[model samples]
Target: MSLPDLPTGWQVWNEEPDGRVILTFRPDVFTEDEYPAECLPTIYVTNGSRKRRPGAGQYQTEEWHVELFLEPEIEVLTETFDTRDAALEGAVDVAGRFADGDVDPRAHYQIPREDYFAALDRLTGDE
Candidate 1:
């Protein structure tokens, strides 16, 4: 129902009563005009228990999960937690990691945008 405490410069991007949340990092810097949609550092938390099949096995258990995306189709981190609070915490943790330069968005995919990478580095204080 409630969002988690995000890292510095991060804010809630989207949320739903059904327990779907999205947090975006440094919205002031990662503007739509300057950065592509894929370059956005986003953390997604979702709980879709009702969507799971009844006869599904243990692996299909409807538990909370936090996914960290450095870019579109590029999930750099995934963590599962037993409780929603834990999942939210995981999301915040990943956000901190991203700001700390522990995660690289461009490493996974061949992004030729030098300006984007440079802006990202500046945003994260790497430059």
Candidate 2:
């Protein structure tokens, strides 16, 4: 998909045991490019028996359109990116944050990537 812009006030969620992440936002908030092919369009569940992705359209969405990723990651758990800017911003946010150490899955916000100092300069400066 084509890369898009990032969204503002967006947040990433990470699992505690491992270090997987889940980004929850509206699709309209991000761009196409922000999402890469490496990112899978699937969710996970702690219970209810883990079902491997049987291709597309096999999974169901939650009441809040929340994607479940029992084994979370950058792609499997991103918010539905609808806009271009938000997408780009999300890429920056993900690479910046997860590139460093893992975060608490239950945490409201995440820590920035260690080497993201350069991107942070632009990420924080963006409008």
Candidate 3:
């Protein structure tokens, strides 16, 4: 159990000046580590519109998106009722989908980077 390594097309981009970090995953690649057993893929990072859904208010809505950049060969994963540890394990298992080869740290989820930044900016008044 060390976690699957990042597949090709997965990458991370950091913008310290903007206080931002992004994780991107190609739709073609996937691993049993992150998804374990699920269907709906979610972006598992901070700074985005962490809120699952927004109301009718004027709040700028931006979901923490994790698009399936995987090639059509791979199927997307979704969430499940696994134990917290199991769920987290699944998340970690798929960690490579969001790894930063340039840095030692890896992203926690498969969410795209730019959307994460935009969601954060809206929250921190950077918007």
lDDT of all predictions: 0.74, 0.34, 0.34
Local distance difference test, candidate 2:
0.34
RMSD of each: 4.6, 13.1, 16.5
Off by over 4 Å in 2: 1-53, 57-76, 102-127
* Candidate 3 lDDT tens digits, 81-106: 22333433444445443332221111
Per-model TM values vs. the true structure: 0.76, 0.25, 0.24
lDDT string for model 1 (65-107, tens) is: 7888767667877788887878888888888888877777666
- Candidate 2 lDDT over 1-120, as tens digits, reads 333332453344333232223443322323345433232222321212124555433343331122433123532344444433444445544543432322223332255433333332
- Which runs of model 3 end up more than 4 angstroms from their true locations? 1-5, 14-21, 26-43, 47-51, 55-92, 95-127
The residue-level lDDT of candidate 3 at 50 comes to: 26
- Span of ten consecutive residues with least summed lDDT in model 2: 40-49
User: What is the overall TM-score of model 2 with all chains considered together?
Assistant: 0.25
Deviation in angstroms for 73 in model 1? 1.3
- Off by more than 4 A, model 1: 49-61, 111-113
Better structure of 2 and 3 per TM-score: 2
Global local distance difference test of model 3: 0.34
The top-ranked prediction according to lDDT is 1
Error of 3 at 9 (Å): 2.4
Winning model by TM-score: 1
Which pairs clash inside model 1?
Answer: none
